[model samples]
Target: MYLTFWGVRGSYPVPGAATVRYGGHTSCVELRSDRGKCLVIDAGTGLRGLGKKLAQEFRKPDGATYNLILSHVHWDHIQGLPFFEPAYIGDTKIVVHAPRAAAKELRQVIGGITRHEFFPVDLDAVPADFEFHEVVPGSAFEIDEFTVLPIGLNHPFGAVGYRVDADGSSMAYVSDTAPFDRMLHKQHFTAGIEEPSDEDREILKTMRANLVESLREVDTVIYDTHFTSEEYEQFPHWGHSTPEHALQICQEAGVRQLVLYHHAPAHDDDMMDRIAEKFGLLGKEANVVVCVAKEKMTLTMGEVTNPGIVA
Candidate 1:
C-alpha cells in the first residue's frame, strides 16, 4: 500500500507565505492499495485536490469507487465532502464509513451538513451512488484488501482512530485526539460536577491500553501532533495532542516510523521546521524514522519518499 498526505494542517485552512511549506488545507490523506483500490481517510479541504487528481488520472467510463473513512464530523474533517469533484460525476460510487452516532444514522450525521440550508447542493442531489456504513468502535472490518480497525479516541462528540493493514504492512491514523487526561475525561463524562470513581480510572486505562495494542509494531503511525508541550498545557481539553504525546506512543508501541500530523494552524513553516528538527534528533536517538507530515509527501511501506510539490 501507499500513503499520501494531501492536507496536513488541523483546525482550518491557512494559506499564506507563512504556511507555504507545510500547507494550509485541513486533514485529508489518501491510501492506495497495490491493487489500485483507493481509500480516503478524511474529507477536509484537501479532498478537493485529491478528487480532481483522481478524476484526471483514474476516472473510468463507469466512474470510480471511493471509500471515505471519517475520523469524526468536525467541520475541518468533513467540510470538503460537498466540494469533492467525484460526487459531481454521475457514475461515481462513494462509500462513507463513520462511527455510529447515538441517535442519528451515519448518513444523517454526514448529510446534515450538506442540507439545503447549509450548502446550495443537497446530499441527495449529488450525482453519485452513495452508501453509508456505521462503524462500531473497537471493531475490525475489511475493505477490499485492507483490514481496518476502528478505535475510539479522546475527542469531543467522539472520534475514532483507524488502523489499516494490507499486504503485510500497516498504518495507523490517530487524528484529533488529546492525550488521555484521566481527570479531564471524568469531567467530560460527569460535566465537572463530581470527582471520578475508581471505575472511571479503570475504564480510561483500558481505552489507552487498547489504543496502544492497536498500534503495536505498525510500520507507520500518523499521529495528531497539533500542539507543542507548552501549547498543550494551555489547551488540555482541546482534543489534540503534542509531539511529546506522539513520541511516547510510538516508542511504547515499537513503531518503525512516525509521521507527525494535524499541525496547529498557527504554526508557520519556520516553526514547523524547528519542531521537525527537534523531533528528528529525538527520532534518531529512539531509532525511529520521524518526519513531520508535509502536503504531498508520499510513503510506501519500507521507505519515505516526498514527490515534492504536487501539481
Candidate 2:
C-alpha cells in the first residue's frame, strides 16, 4: 500500500508564494492498495487536484470506485467536494464514511456543503452513485483491502482519527485534536472553557489511551500539529495539537515515523522549515523519524523513502 499527501494545511486554503513550499490546501490524503483500490481521507481543496488525477486514470466504462473517510465535517475538510470532478461522472462510485451526527444523517451533513445556494450543483444532482455510511468510533470496518478503526478525537462537533491496516502494515491518521490534558470537546464548541471537571479528566484520559493504543507500533503516524507550544497555550480549546504533544503520543505508542501535519495557515514556508528542523531533531532523540508533511509527498507503507526524515 502507498500513502500520499495531497493537502497539509489546516483551517483554510492558503495559496500564495509564501505557502508554496509546504502547500496551502486543507486536509486530504490518498491511500492506495497494491491492487489499485483507493481510499481517500478528507476532501479539502487538495481533493480538487486528486480528483483531476482520478478522472484521468479511471476513464473506463466501469469508472472508478473510491471510498472517502472523513474525520469531521469542518468546512476546510469537506469544502473541495463541490469541485471534485469525479462526482460529475455517471459511473463513478463514491462510498463516504464519516462521523455520525447526533441530529443529522450522514448525507444531510456531508451533502450540505454542496447545497444549491453554496455550489451550483447539489450532491443529489451529481451523476455519481454515492453511498453514505456513519462511522461509529471504536468500531472496526473493512473497505477494500484495508481494515479501518475510527478513534474518537477531542474536537468541536466531534471528530475521529483513523487507524488503517493493510498488507501487514499500519498507518494512523490523527488530526484536528487538542491535547487530551486540556479542554474536552463534545457536541458544542468549548473555546473559553479552560478547566475540566473530575469526570472530564477521566474521559480525556480514556480518550488519549484509546488514541495511543490505536497507533501502537504503527509504521507511520500523520498527526495534527497545527499550533506551536506558545500558540497552543493561548488557544487550548481550539482542538489542535502541537508538535510536542504529537511527539509524546508517538513516543508512548512506539511509532516508527511521525509526520507533522495540518500546518497552520499562518505558518509560511520558512516557519515550516524551522518546525521540520526542530522536531526532526526531537524525533531523533525519541528514536522516531519525524518530518513535516508537504503536498504531493508519497510514502510506501513499511518503507522509508522520503529524504526529509533521516532514516
Candidate 3:
C-alpha cells in the first residue's frame, strides 16, 4: 500500500511563504494499493494539483474510478471539489464518502461550489456521473481490496475518523478531532439524555480507543497534530491535538510508525522544524518518534520494501 499527503493545513486555507514547506492547502490524501487502485481523502485545494497528476499518470483516463473519503464538510475540506478536474471529465467515475448526521446536508456541503457567487462555473455543468455514499458512525464498507471503517470523533461539527485495512497493512486517518473533550458536551447537554446514554458514552470511548487500537501492532498511523502547546492552550475546543498528545497516543497504542498530520497554516518550515525537534526528543525518550508528512511524499507499507523508521 502507498500513502500520499496532498494537503496538510487545517481549519481554513492559508497559502503564503510561511506555510509552503509543510504546505498551505487543506486536507487531501491519496492512497494506492499494489494493484493501482486508489482512495482519496478530503478534496481541498490540493486536489486540484492531484487531479492534474492523475490525468498524466493514467493516459487512458476514461473509465477510471475515483473514490473520495471526506473527514467533514467544512469548506477548507471540500472547497476544491469543483477545482478537481476529474469531476469535470465526462468519463471518470467518482464516489464520495461523507458523514451523515453531524452537520451540513450533502447538498449544502457540495452544492453550487464550482459556480457560486465566488467561482465561475457550477458543478452541474461538469460532465461526470457522480455517486455519493453518506456514511454515519459505525458503518463499514469495502472498496477494491480494502476495508474502511468510520468512527465518530469529538468535533464542534461531527467528523468521522477512519480505520482502513488493506493486504494486512492498516492505517488510521483522523484529520480533525479534539483529543478528549466530549465531557464539555456531556456537561452542556446534561438535560438532554434521559440517563446519560451509556451507549453514547461507550461509542465515544470506543472511538477514542480506535485510535489506540489502530496503532496496536499496526503498520502506519496518520493522525491530526495541528497545534503547538501554546496554540492548543488557547483553543481547547477546536478539533485538533498537540504533538505531545500524538506521541502519548502512539506510546499507549504501540503503533510502530507515526506520521503527524493536519499542520497549522501558520507553522512554516522553521516553526515546524522546531516542533519536529521537540517530537524527536520525546520520541528518543519514549522510544516512539513520529515524522511529519510532506506534500507528494510517498510512504510504502508492508514488510518487503519499507525499511526501519522512514524519517
Candidate 4:
C-alpha cells in the first residue's frame, strides 16, 4: 500500500514564508492500493497541487479510478474539490464516499466555495465522470485490496475517521476534533474557559470514552495534534487537540507509530520538527514518529516495520 499526504493543514489554507516548510496546503491525502485503486481523502486546497502532480505522472489513455472518502464537509477539508482539475476533466472518474446522513451537508460544503457568489464556477457545472454515495459509520467496505473501517468522531460539525487496511498493511487517519471531551460539551470546553456543569462533565467523559474507543490502536495512527498545550489557550474550543493530549491517547491505545497531523498555520517546518521530537520524548521508549505531514511525504505499511523504530 502506498500512502501519500497531499495536505495536512487545519482550519484554513496558509501560504507564505512562515508556513513554507509545512508546505502550506489544506487537507488532502491519497492512498493507492498495490492494485492501483486510488483512495483520496479530504479535498482541501492541497488537492489542486496533487491533481497537478497526478496529471503529470498518472494520466493514462483510460481515465483514473478514484474514490473520495470525506471526513466531513468543513471548508478546510472539502474546499479544494472545486479546484481539483481531475474532477473537472471528463476523463477522470471520481466516486465520492461520504457520510450517508450528511451527503447533502458534504455537497453544501463543496458547493459553498464554488457558488458564483464566492468563486466563478458552479459545483454542478463540473463535468467530471462523478458519483456520490453516503457511507455508513462502523461499516467496512472494500475496493481492490483495501478494506476500510469507519468510525464516527466527535466534532461539532460531525466527522468520521478511517482505518484502512490494504493487503495486510493498516493505517488510520483521524483529524479535526477538539480534544474529544470538548466537542461533546461545547459550552464547557477547556478552550472556552468555562466551568463544566456536572452534566456537561459527564457528557464530556462519555464522549471522550467514545473517541478513545474509536482511535484504539491499529498500526499507523495519523491524528490531530495541531496545537501544544500552551497554544490551546488561544483557541480552546475551536476543535484541535494538543500534542500532550495526543501523546496520552496514542499511549493509551498502544499505538505502534504516531504521526502528528493537522498542523497549525502558525507553525513552521522547523517548529513542527521540534514538536515531533518533543512527542517522541513522550513516547517513553515506544515506537513513535510524530512528524507533521507534507504535500509529498509517503508512509506505507511496510515502512513502519522496517528497520529500527525506536520507541
Question: Best candidate per lDDT, number?
Answer: 2
Mind giving the per-residue lDDT tens digits that candidate 3 earns over 197-274? Answer: 667677567767876765576667777898897888777666678888877877887776678888887788788888
Per-residue lDDT of 1-311 in model 4, one digit per residue for the tens?
66788888887888888777667888899887665466888888888887886666556677776778888777888888877877667677777887743435645655667779888878777767667767666788986677887776656556778888876677888877667554352323353545557786776677567656656666677888878888887777677788777767767776776778888888887888788677777765555555557767877664443223211
**After best superposition, candidate 4 residue 167: deviation in angstroms?**
1.1
> Candidate 1: which stretches are off by over 4 Å?
182-197, 303-311
Which of the predicted structures, 2 or 4, would earn the higher lDDT when compared with the native? 2
Where in model 2 is the C-alpha error above 4 Å? Answer: 303-311
lDDT of 2 by residue, 1-311 (tens): 67788999999999889999889999999887666678999999999999998888876776777799999999999998888889988888889999985778899888887777888888998999889999998999999889999999998878999999987788989988998997788776554766888999999999999999899999889999999999988888788999999999999999999999999999999999999999999999999899999999888776433334311
User: Which prediction has the highest TM-score against the true structure?
Assistant: 2
Candidate lDDT scores, in order, read 0.85, 0.89, 0.74, 0.73
Task: Provide C-alpha RMSD values for all models, in order.
Answer: 3.0, 3.0, 4.3, 4.2
| All candidates: TM-score | 0.92, 0.96, 0.86, 0.85
Report how far off residue 73 is in candidate 3 (Å).
0.8
- Residue 308 lDDT in candidate 2: 40
| TM-score of predicted structure 2 | 0.96
Return the TM-score for candidate 4, rounded to 2 decimals: 0.85
Scored by lDDT, model 4 comes in at 0.73
For residue 241, what is the lDDT in candidate 2? Answer: 96
lDDT of 1 at 38: 79
Cα lDDT tens digits, model 1, 223-277, are: 9999999988777767788888888888888999999999999999999999999
